[model samples]
Target: MTELLLVGIGTGNPDHITLEGRKALQGADLILIPRKGPEKSDLAELRRRIVLQSVRDGMDRVVEFDLPVRDPDLPYLEAVERWHDAIAELWAVTLAAHPDAHSAALLVWGDPSLYDSTLRIAARLDPTPKVRVIPGITALQALTAAHAIPLNTLAGSVEITTGRRLRDTGWPDGAETVAVMLDGACAFETLDPDGLQIWWGAYLGMDEQILSAGPLEEAAPHIMRIRAEARDRHGWIMDTYLLRRTGVPG
Candidate 1:
């Protein structure tokens, strides 16, 4: 019975790791770290650092495997399904190499419950392993904390959505605030920006973090420039932002 622990490492900051997550890392028999190509190798490196600094070394083995790349030609959902299947096959193969290990762990980027695919991929394993999720700080928390702003207004509801959805749907009904994630494009530009105030942050908890806030109209261009410049400098960037409609009642 392999116990698969998905430990959340939090948005690129090792200090954001929770005590429970640290304990899970220590308890694992093997830890699988995925290498996402040279451009994103820093991601894998972060997990490596976490395992090195936290995991009790005695009998625990840390294994690094190359992650499967998704085909861009396929439709979004189809490509995702194929990608997950490939990853599951990769995982099975990785696990087979270390047949003696009964328990394995993977360090997730943020709280696995929020927008991460590890849990979904874990479900695809054969004779499925018992899954345990240890939570960590989320990008949303990092964004709000960095700006020192409340995610919601007085008694106002927040709609957590992706950049694509926001771009397609314009603005959601009922919710006074919309927090956007996985937005490579500055989708907020599609909105009227008449009464919306946006708080944007990139590399949320990392050393090169950037924070910007103001009325969407005034701040949108600045965020776009900053995001582009940061990406140019770092070769990659992870960002999230919150958009609030001004004058919305509680």
Candidate 2:
């Protein structure tokens, strides 16, 4: 049986990769890195660099593959399924290319448990490989660490959600703080800015990282402008933020 390992490398920082992830990288017989074209070449390049750093024998074992684009015209769930199927098919082809290898690893962004689909896609492999995950620092952890802020205040609960959900439904019930991800649109602007605090970061943990925080009312506009400018400059952006209800720790 082929053994599949998913290693979380964390945001874009080399230091963010955990010892466990490093060990997994070193142990793998094959490492598959996905390339998302030139626009996101940095993503693939970072993984390649990390592997080189972690495993002395990594370059020969590494396989770079193209990622399938989800057709934007299809319904959301349908598009995801089609995209995932294509990826799984590619995974099988890539695996077959190295018949002698029993163990393979993929470099995942953030902890595999949070907002990542590597595991889900792995399930689609026929006679699925025995899968293992090495957790890395999540975007949430990196964001909070970069800003020197606590994830939550004194036992207060936080809701983790996506940008689509934030825009569809305002703040969730019992959510003292909301950590929003996959929100390229900056959905936080839709909510009433009164009595809210927002901590925002783009490209967290990278050399080009940018951070902003304060009362949501005053900071939202500034965050929007900066976010747009950064995305335009870089051609892509990955951002996450935490919005907390002011004085609601009681």
Candidate 3:
């Protein structure tokens, strides 16, 4: 049976990779890097840099494959499921090409346990490879650190949700603070700005990082404008934000 290592590399920063994550990368017999199209070529390049930095030998073990794109026409959940199946198939095919490789590794952005689907896709492998996870810094941790703020106000609760959920279901009831990820749309615009404060960061832990914060009403438009400009310049973006309601004691 093959061993699959899911190594968290954090948000595109080579330094964010933990010592354990680097060791996992070095130990793998095969390293699979996904090419996410021209718009996001930088992502693949970043992974390449990490592999080069971590793996001192057998550069030939590193492999690149095209990532499957989701069909926008299909329902969201259905599209994601289908896309994941395609990725699993690709992984199986790649692994089959190198029968001698007993250990394979994939570098994950941020901690694999949070808002990541790599583990789920690995489950679809027919032989069910032995899975190992090497944790790394997460975007949430990077965001809070970049802004020099705690995830939650003194002893208050924090709810982590996606941008789509925030736009669809509104703020989670009784959550003093909410952290939103995978938000392509500025979902914060949908909420009433009253009593809300926002701390937003994009490209967390990278040199291209940008940050914004303040009362939601005052900061929302600025965040929206800058987000658009940054996406235009960089061709893609990954962002996260924390929203806290007023009346929560600091």
Most accurate candidate by lDDT? 3
148-188: candidate 1 lDDT, tens digit per residue: 98888888788999998989898998768999999989899
The residue-by-residue lDDT of candidate 3 on 1-250, one tens digit each, is 3799999999868899999988898889999999999999999999989988988873678989999899999999999999999999999999999999899999999999999999999999998999999998999999999999999889888899999999999989998999999999999999999999999999999999999999999999999999999999999999999999988997
lDDT of 2 by residue, 185-225 (tens): 99999999999999999898899999999999999999999
List candidate 2 stretches off by more than 4 Å: none
Clashes (backbone N, CA, C under 3 Å), per candidate, total 0, 0, 0
Worst 10 residues of 3 by lDDT: 54-63
Q: What's the lDDT for candidate 1?
A: 0.89
| Candidate 1 local Cα displacement, residue 38, angstroms | 0.7
RMSD to the true structure for each prediction, in A, is 1.4, 1.1, 0.8
Computed on alpha carbons, the lDDT of every model, listed in order, comes to 0.89, 0.92, 0.94
Model 2 clash tally, residue pairs:
0
